[model samples]
Target: MSQHHISEVPVEQREIGMLAKHREHIIDQIDELVKRTKYLELLNECQRHGLLSPGMCQNIKEYTPGRRNENEEDLLLERHRQLFKKLTQRGPRAYETIISVLESLDCKEAANVLLSVDSGSFVSLREANKSRRPGMTVVDEGVTTEGLVLSKVSKESKYQYLNPNEPLVPYTKPVQNSKRIVKKSDKCHEDAVTGTYPMCSQYNRGVLFMVNIIDFPNPGVIRNGAFKDGEELIHLFREIGFTIFPYINLNKEQYMRILKELTSSQYVENTECFVMVLMTHGNRVNQIDRAEFHDGSIAMVQTEIIAHFQASNCRKLANKPKILMFPFCRGPEPDKGVETDGRSAASPKPTAQPKRNIPTLSDSLVCYASTEGFETLRDPDTGSWYIQKFCDVMAEYAHNTSFEDILKKTQSLVQNMRTATGHLQTGNYKNIGFNKKLYFNPGFYK
Candidate 1:
């Protein structure tokens, strides 16, 4: 006879069962019609924000205890539990309302009830509480994924948190000035409806411009691993709704020209988001190296690249999410085999230039594979550790999780990975200035 061992159940699961059992008691506290209306409204809001699919909404609408099969009903309830969990994490007012309703019904384990519904939701709920407003009404910030703060004022009439001294720029659509001459080249990009390729297709959620530089003038610095990175990214981004545009082996002039052209492309105007992936050799000063087949190697400063997409420059893509992924060496220093014997001699550094501000360069994210003055590792078979973990985590959680949350998880995953030589790779994320929670609608391309 085979012996079966019964393991101890998790505290969260037990709590969930307890909450489910007392679901009726909580329901009794709220007016049935009002509760139903609120639930429906929440679902609609979720749908509008790309958090829930049409099929998910339909499933909720048709939910009945015995009408559907047992398994189907269980799945439906599980989805409901997920929704409740997400609300707790990202919806401050809804979570507060749920907790208040439970407490009013004399449920002492209100926190347990929330944990039971969604195990990983406790941290999110705690974070939400930190920024909760005084009133009960939802205050949509209109930018971030963490939905409106609770307030007495209605959402439309509610004032945003702004500095009293700085003059505010009202969010408005861009209009063409009659006196300004429109250049023929400025009217770029093929018509989406008539475009044949996926990169130019109207159905795509966004454009992914990948620049891969493999062969350098120096044999030691040749990026044999870059092609693999491109392949991996293409597969990953496609699943997440990006139309991939791979530009490989471009010299310095060609790469710069292409980037400048893309900034003014009509495609940027139509796309919901923009992604730029750079897989190349770079320096500590944030300059990417390019192979000049005829002349030699040249460097392109990272700021010059980013400036092309600035608000004053690329008006069409202003305020939209711009994600830049750089999987390259920030410096020549290796991670391992450093000499601890003696103090190193200090060297004179180059003088830095004065910085100019671009106010419109908000809503951008820059992901660096390694920090300044360090070298990141790459796998010949797979790809860079950061990119691989980033794609994996994004593929699994991008649909429901906020980009910030997803990136945090990816950072954690990257930090946990160790190389064969026992050297660990660490990545850096710079949130340029995104106010809204960025997300790709699940099954958008499908």
Candidate 2:
């Protein structure tokens, strides 16, 4: 793409035009030195009020004769310098005008220079410098003839007082560097998505609980790659707006106790949602078992786990969203080899299942790594296939997209990935028991 000269574009359209281009979007970033918008108006006011002499105004007007790119930038820098000088002198109605012009030009550095040299900060110093003792000379104290006061000099005898924060020199405008626009990673898209809704800073959003098991007493049952999965999930959830509570290497009894406490009214108060991330090893006995603690070997029922957080059981979370993610293997059966022709078949479109009339689990969304009796795939370098896809999809499209839509995309993406052994793996979303369609406020967070 060809680079456009700054002088060719109108001031207002500069940002918009740069954003419209696909390749040069980073050029729309705020410039260090902002060009003055009301240069003629300020010049006219200074000349009429005699704040600046006619000769000084004429010199400013004739600083640069041409509208070339280099010359225009140079003229803008000079105007900023003149404005800073006038601001120091405390000209009538000049502070408001200069501040407004700097804000309009998006000149943050120049604005800082103006605000740093505040009028109020100089009043005391100016008065002190003008007040001198009648008989106190440099030779009277242990001071030199160059007006350098000694440390023993009294506060009243000091000639000059300067605020260290304010500098006498004008701030030099920095040249714009070609900073590479950082794109979101393939495995995790943190801030890639853009939307119109403002981010709600009230922080009424809920809490997230990550239950990870990395160490097991039995050396044979080592969860090598599970720790990375939990770390990534914590970072991802926290970024989108969830207060994270990481529970690592907990036994069965401790897990239940924590869950019970979280479901209570005191813990769940003022929370909009709850997220439970479980990463551990499981067996055919229908329970997650990995570590051996003081309270025997860890073994907890999956059905009972979800049932404990039901609306009837946990009244505080009634009518609120509860997300449950399980990234561990459900069974020991790995995907076996299969021979087939290189032909693809069209899959049927997904349809929403009809709501049940009987009493059922409510206000909960549960996800599993694989279907029943199948083993899930995990990459040693990256995390599980299901979790990586789920996080990436949620990060990029969760702002405006529904939670169900994000899950559907994650499912399709995970299903298309093949394991290192040429085995296909798929994730299952079971027990989606919410009454209405659920959506996350990814647009708002802490």
Candidate 3:
């Protein structure tokens, strides 16, 4: 009972302390393993019920308590089956309890403590969580009762807010290509008895006409410069199949008579598609010439031209495309004025008015030389900028693309050329209402 016996007692006490610590560690490990097993089982039950995503199954498999050994896997499977059956009977409350326990431990601490017992299952669990629930909120991961409640509540609330009587604001007008004015007229005379005129039948082929009135004297003269490019334009269209009609030297009466004759019972009766190319000087609303004045003047043609064509007698051209190419300077006044602070305060002025005098063709295309009110430029050598581009593009792409495509390409090319090369710009004012595509291919192959 001397020094040896005393050292033996201390050693025994140390061994007891070590055993107690190891037992506590084992208890903690068992608790986490049991919690994870329940979580996996609950998730599997949810999958069977179609409540859980496929991702949950993979996550649970990784966290399951097991090894490659048959006995351990069997034990893990039994635990999973038991827990799943319990969850199916008791519902999500059992799973919620397990999640609450897991949340109490720091995620990294829990992984470290759990990893040593069965590395394979723990690794799988970690991988599943990393893939499916990385940075996911409780609500997004659907791991808690509160999260599930929120998901259901949100869906129900959305259904309650469904509305049927909301007012609709159209993003764009439906009657884009059809002239609103024409539709108004048709609506006005819906019940009227009208005789139909077959203009194309009376005429052998479609009538293509161009009216250019360049040299007008005095206040009667709407455009100031010399005949810029009207003749050039006429020639371009002529090459494309237009029957050139020079109205440049005609007096007021003569011009009116020619238009009337064209719109008369005999001429319009047989015309298939009517094209009028007008090149003249124009203000915002009127086309001016020597000695005579016409209001609502579009080029040299009066507004009545469209109204005349819409007449019941001119049914042959009904729904047929009517193409009008007008190259003229339009608007009230040029945008020029004084500056302030010794700096030019002027912004680039608008090129033209938004309104164009284009007829609705459902069968038609109206290519304006400039935007609404901007002055169209004419090269003393080449003619009007827009007319030149229009003629060029139409001649080139008429057979290759649809009329709409041609117009779009023409608009883009003309705008680019004008902005790059000239101060004045041109644009096509398109309002298409054609039932069928117009193929201007007569001169393409020739």
Model 2 collision count? 0
Clashing pairs in 2: none
Ten consecutive residues with minimal summed lDDT in candidate 1? Answer: 9-18
lDDT of 1 by residue, 391-440 (tens): 66666665544567667777666655553333444677777666466655
Q: Quote the RMSD, in angstroms, for model 3.
A: 35.4
**lDDT, each prediction:** 0.49, 0.48, 0.39
Query: How would you encode candidate 3's per-residue C-alpha lDDT over 406-440 as one tens digit per residue?
Result: 66666666555421112334566555444355544
Give the Å error, residue 325, model 1: 1.3
If the candidates were sorted by their TM-score against the true structure, best first, what order would they fall in? 2, 1, 3
In the order shown, what is each candidate's alpha-carbon RMSD? 24.9, 30.1, 35.4
TM-score of 3: 0.41
Better of 1 and 3 by TM-score: 1
Candidate 1 residue 66 C-alpha distance from true site, Å? 78
